[model samples]
Target: MSHSTNLSHHSRRIDLDAPLHRKAGPMTHAMQPVESAGEAQTSQACPTPRYLTNSEAAAFLRLSPRTLEKQRVIGGGPRFHKFGRRVMYAVTDLEAWAGERSFETTFDPEYIDRHPGVQRDDQ
Candidate 1:
């Protein structure tokens, strides 16, 4: 129920009774980088849904976290799940919702009226 981490500029172990991706109080840990490129490739080959905190999901979607919170309240953000009191988003759901909002032009109905800041970048 604990994982290896280096917090407070010192090596320590942290309990993970909840999901590892969730922030522990004010302390949030980033995915630890591997020691070698081989490890990086290995990790990428075994893809996992990266669970994101609301703030992290907001950064990933180029929105303010407050916007996500509002979306949660009023409905219609990317699908998210609650781990008890914690709210977590899956990368897959975020990508799917972003894909759903993709539009070709700024004048597209959904683009202008509904999802103002989102557009399909065909790149």
Candidate 2:
């Protein structure tokens, strides 16, 4: 089998049976061609937001949907938005909330600040 490739305004035929050789050069975004103006406008006209449902958000965060519902009612959970009567979670908000809980150690200063009742040997 053979394949035709167009590079630098020149068409070349490649023999698939031949052994492939690596070329040392800077990587380029040639594989991803630039979007045309019409395509860009169409995308802009119907932009899709990254919103997840309660169950999907829970799955993404590795938690139970019931836990998220409880948090929504009580407190302590990622930020969420309500669309009419539906609850929605944005990926960015989830990431930010998870980022806030990140700690280098169990006794991290920020963690201690968030949980003042937590006793630390250094205290």
lDDT (Cα, tens digit) per residue for candidate 2, span 4-116: 67577866778753435323332224222245468778868987767889987887787999999999989999999999999999878998998889899867888888886
For model 1, residues 60-83, the per-residue Cα lDDT tens digits are 787999999999999998999999
Lowest lDDT 10-residue stretch of candidate 2: 24-33
How high is the lDDT of residue 83 in model 2? Answer: 94
What's model 2's TM-score? 0.57
Residue 51 in model 1: shift from native, Å?
0.2
In angstroms, how far off is 12's CA in candidate 1? 34
Q: List per-prediction Cα lDDT, in the order shown.
A: 0.78, 0.77
Model 2 residue runs over 4 Å out of place are 1-48, 120-123
TM-score of 1: 0.54
